[model samples]
Target: MAPSPVRPRGRGGYWLFLIPGFVLFTVVIVVPFVMNVATSFTRWSGVGTPTWIGFGNYTKLFEDERFWTSFEHNAALIVAMAVVPTVIGLVLSAALFDYIGKKFGPRTASALRAAYYLPQVLPVAVAGVVWNWMLHPSYGAVNAIFGTKVNWLGDPGLALATVMAIMVWFQLGYPVVIFMAGLQRADPALHEAAEIDGASWWRRFWHITIPQIRPEIFVVLLTCTIAALKVFGPIFVLTRGGPGNATMVPSYFSYLNFFEKANVGYGSAIATVLALIIVVVTFLFLRVQERDS
Candidate 1:
């Protein structure tokens, strides 16, 4: 018999591969996060010495009505980006995979999926600018088509709603793609067996499809919720948190405080708080998922 290959030395060499990534992560993420937390306890204007102010920034942030309003907008965004999209994506993915794919062809299903995912591939800035122009009160395509001068992004009452709708559209594609991919892992035989048992589509969806893709649903909701909380680009391009802060969210609020107002310390505090909330939310989501699993 051929001599057995010498046993590889203890797998210690593989650990070296992690060093580069670990270093990069520390420099890019860990260092900045630590600096940010330190900055939150001071009064800094991005330049010059930071004056230590303890929890003053946090104290002020809590009392700022704008902060509360921003969070309230974030809550609505969570609904639009996470809740609504997940529900709709579930239905759409199931239909596209089970019904359209079988009835029309795989090519047709893929084409439709690509169309839905088109928005996700577009740069956020470009999408925001296009939407802004299309929703313009004066020359917007939407208003022109409808022959109505509705200030889609300018009216405080309508601004948040408009933003929410835009978010829903922008976010729908992500869940659809994710859920469709997850559905690929689902056992086709289960669906066939259910069908053979005279199970209707709705019954099969509720009993088989949903359970099969539960993990994807959880992942989508978590990511979308975090994205909603940190949303800033669209608000910056579309309304700049204008029309009386109707579309303001924590990330935009922090941006305003940091650059526009030159209140670096306060901005750091806002960022810290937002980060904390995201951590808590993630922890809660994980715990719930663990329990269910």
Candidate 2:
């Protein structure tokens, strides 16, 4: 007789648990992505067999001035959504956590956090529509406050910036929550030591708090970049890519081509390009994080 065979260290059934999620991912994400890439090579009317156009769609896309403008608008939005919001959230979170929480209580900090996060809880459409009306030239709250007619959404020059500002408002909450949670993980002794060394609040924040919350910073940056890149709802509801396409981003551009114009091939190419950019950016961010770590 031989010794009894050892059982596997883990449950083979664990993989079975992943099967459902794996299947759903394949159906929803994988299939659509592959099909879109394939469709990008064809000129299709969304009905019959699509004509193979090679890279004509891509060539046209690169030459389209509006496409480049949309890309530039997206880059601007990343600054508004990721850069500005992160800076503001970091300051607010540090103030609430390191100052207010120390003196008053955690409850007050929590209340402030909730207030900051309230805008994020609203449905995107509702937020868009509400802001749309609030920025109306005549009767909107913005005009009402100053008692002047300002076309917040209608003016080509100012419309994109207005949308970007609203994005900053909505994107503020995530970093606050993340940074506050990160603050909780920070060692209290570091603060005490810094204080003993006569470090100023700003000094301590720059030296200690930021280093401790680096992971949260990366997470917020990555997410906000992606969100800003693909942002659609507010642009759709408020500006409708109007005022001569000032607020148009690639996401809306793709939507217009696919649904409104029925140019499936060009739309698919735009979508694929946008997806590729997201993937490349994500990869680069992760690589930088790894190197820094």
Candidate 3:
């Protein structure tokens, strides 16, 4: 009889590779989040013994008009950062790839892509400073160009809109880059075949291109929506959630409570609620994607 073949080793060794990542995640994310959730239930001022006040912070938060207003602003930011950018990026990426790259050359297409992505690479602080200078009512470049003084960040009526526009500019580049990359994976033959069948650019875009890049579109929308929700850097740098809280977002509101107001429990409650919203949104997006797939 032939010797029995040696049995193969199990794949159990692969489990070892996850140890480092699991430990890091537990220490960094899990621990902190659990602590935050616990803190949200108590009245703490960042020091001393904490007073237990279960759901009090949440109750107060729901009753605050500022909290509602901040959420409203976040909804606008979602439109600016996620909705507008995805639509515009899809069109721009298709035009650049199918039209410009073919007509003018890859070099021209690349240059335009780089220009669009430039703002994304700039440091937020630097961008904010430049924008602030350019929008200053007294001696701004925009005012000089238009021959009109406009308080871009100081006026309550115009501040949120101005921030939304700025967010659109900053966010447009991200989806453009992501969608262009996704388009590279698409079958060029489909577009060519559609063209051969006398399909217009819009028709091909609607029928073929959109379906091919559906996954990328979903990814961009989900990530951008989350980014818009937690947006703090731009608010901190540009408005500090001001013109009388006109641009107050949940993240900045939480920040103000944590540091300025020294209401750690309230801040933690805000953060916890924000986290829950993000988790719910992510779950819905994943469910939709799964159903679509």
Candidate 4:
């Protein structure tokens, strides 16, 4: 009645609070993403004017056998790391959550979990160097210890698989931790009910355990898939896409085009393709999640 006593400026303040974050997002993500796409259509070598060149870069990507091979490699890696690792992590976490965590107590189990998670905390560069040393074909500690002189990173047959091994080893820890956390949050009463019904460990795991942790599995799959798609560091340091380009990934290919070949436009085109693939894969995963839910 008193002219609806002036409303507090809370909504206005909320709007004000969003401005800085919005500006940062626009500047950092939106701007760079737009520019990268724009660069895909131009003929620039990182120095001169970026002359617009229509779809020439895309044309080249399709024509180049190496580019297509890189794409295939990326697909294989995504399957191995994303699908395989997620399953492995889930299984390990489920087993640990079911038996070990209960027996060992949460604090002790957490300490052991951190032990498994050591690789993730270490610098990737250091991991690469260590792997390189361990896989040195002749004088490597791996060969010395195992009494085999297998060239892990030298042969074309083993190079990609070797890189995949490194990836799986280093990346497994994080997903295990995430899955463990998810497993911990699940209702204990569900387990008790299952046990009361005489459900075996494997049956209970297949039924109660997996369904409860589906969300965490989806998260691990998304993250692992993205990481696999962009796997460049260890390959760059350890293989350089070597052993006859057996380990050439999309990201490394893009880096080669941009820096090694001085073909920024073509590199940007490859990057655009990669971005599109990632988007498609992620969207498909989201659909799968929705259906599962």
Best by lDDT: 3
* Error of model 1, residue 248, in angstroms: 0.9
Candidate 4 weakest lDDT stretch, 10 residues: 5-14
- Model 1 Cα lDDT, one tens digit per residue, 1-293: 99976667766687898999999999999999999999999999999999999999999999999999999999999999899999999999999999999999989999999999898888877789889989988889999998898999999889999988888888899999999999999899999999999999999999999999999999999999998888888889988998888888899999988999999999999999999999999999999999989
TM-score of 2: 0.93
Ranking by TM-score: 2, 3, 1, 4
- The number of clashing residue pairs in model 4 is 0
Off by over 4 Å in 2: 1-19
Question: What lDDT score is found at residue 98 in candidate 2?
Answer: 84
lDDT of 2 by residue, 1-293 (tens): 89866667666857988999999999999999899999999999899999999999999999999999999999999999999999999999999998999899999999999999999898877889889889988789999998879898899999999998888888899899999999999998999999999999999999999999998999899989998888888888988888899999999999999999999999999999999999999999999899989
- Native-vs-model 3 lDDT? 0.94
What's the lDDT for candidate 1?
0.93
Backbone clashes under 3 angstroms, per model:
0, 0, 0, 0
Comparing 1 with 2 on TM-score, the higher-scoring candidate is 2
TM-score of each: 0.92, 0.93, 0.93, 0.90
Expressed as tens digits, the lDDT of each residue in 112-178 for candidate 4 is: 7787789899788789999999999978999999999899999999888888788788887887899
